[model samples]
Target: MKIWGYLSALTVAILFGVWFSLDKTLLGYLHPIVLASATYLIASCFLFIINFSPLKKKILKIINSKSKVEDFITKKEYGILFLTAIFGSVIAPAIYLNGLNRITAVNAALLANVEILFIILIGVFFLKEHVKRKDIVGFVFLLIGAIFLSTNNLQNIHFDASLFGSILVIVSCFFWSMDTSLSKFLSHKSNIIYITALKCAIGGLILLLISISLGLSFSLPLDKLPLLLFIGLVCLSISLPLIYFAIRIIGSTRTGSIFALSSLFGAITAFLVLGEPLTVTQLSFGVLMIIGVYILYMGDNDQNV
Candidate 1:
């Protein structure tokens, strides 16, 4: 991993840390589906404004050069892009936000670190990436930390609502893992801005249609529009592209390992911004997660993974 790789990972961690906490706050004002749809819609609009001209010129340049546009973005890439939209921007957000509504932002952020596990699984099996012993050890630490956070340090053992919420977050991470791997591949095919923009636009449209079918309220307070814009621009637009760039540079597993820091950043941000209490258990498990991520960082070699 290069310095830019590390920078991208840390930047995404901080951005998503604040974004996840604000997501919990927004859930109070808007339904999960509605908020997801609206925010992504805003992101789509922002991307269009920023990239439409550049993308148009690029496409025309390709045409003028007598190269097949398909050479740049093929049918298979389109298919992968559609899947990324469905899983990344649509289903993953819906499930994660629903789970976030059920649980604390701190817990949601912590469990989201499990995305690295799923990403590794997918990479090793489907993508045929090699995993090392140190990677496994780091994963163990992260798993233990996640278990501690989910179980509240062994205080809550039963399969209660909190457990269910944790499961939902885990499942959401699984989908996001799929999205991350596919998006990494896609980054080689197209500009991250174009891919992120188009995916969010299509996914937002789908979610909005679903919200309409489900008769969910579409109304948002006048004061909250700016917050939604901030989320769209900062979280979805800027942060997502950076994550894709990191995935391209460092691979999903390494990127995700560094992304585990989002839990620590998110928990602290939730405490400060949302006034969520930072309990001893949360803090302890957060430290454990940081240790796990540090191990992961140490384990990475000078290679791309």
Candidate 2:
């Protein structure tokens, strides 16, 4: 089961890696806020279908769940979900997208690593989640690999943008980290679909409202609808569910650490999907990240308690 948890995290890394590439591509069609709002809203709708579907009872039996989505989550969980949605699905994406527009991929990847660090700190200090000695060592390995990959082994350095963009990325990462830690509260719950749906609904609606107030263009090209659907239905819907499930079994700290590889994986996917060059240095450090994850998995000492 623990190994399965590890695999689920790995799968999330891949799925989100794909999402990052797709997200970058879709920005040409819609405003960042609009794209984000659409993706999250669509994801929420998909989850809503599952939650209230006629087959919901059968699905419950499959997962051995007793509670229905309508009443399973408590008010406390609702509060946590609302906060997480604001930090992650709302603020983080908007800031991260704007930041991405300013900085090079190199700087973004390096700074984005703060997400996992924040997660670990919150998980250990605030959440009181325990990790083994092996966890520390593995995290070191993972961080080292991430650094090398992010900097491209220090081969070609570029600081094209001012520090403002970098700061935005870091700030956005902080909010995302907050979301990861807060969502840990729901990791023990049975209704992942409800958790994801409500979070997305709240986040998406808020973003939509912000866009409306700012009078941002919501003109989505019809040609872009397929990719839009894919992003919302596949990335947010599928990826987030997998993330919540993995968090349930593995804890948010480790899961966030492993999921951090998504950027490294994104580099690889960009090469494949966008016809970008794949450097040998990148391939090397990418493998190192994988090794680090394996080491981390070797030390799943506590099941988030």
Best by TM-score, which number?
Answer: 1
Name the TM-score of candidate 2.
0.82
lDDT of 2 at 103: 51
lDDT per residue (tens digit) for residues 1-305 in model 1: 35776798889988888888888888988999899999899888887776767664664353224211222777888899999999989999999898888889988888888887787778778977777777677678778978887777777789888877777888888998888788766755445667778999989999999999999997778898788889888887778777766776666777877777788788888889888888887777777766766765674564536
Query: Looking at candidate 2, what is the lDDT of residue 304?
Result: 54
Residue-pair clashes per candidate, as listed? Answer: 0, 0
Q: Pick the candidate with the highest lDDT.
A: 1
lDDT for each candidate structure:
0.79, 0.72
What overall lDDT, based on C-alpha atoms, would model 1 receive against the true structure? Answer: 0.79
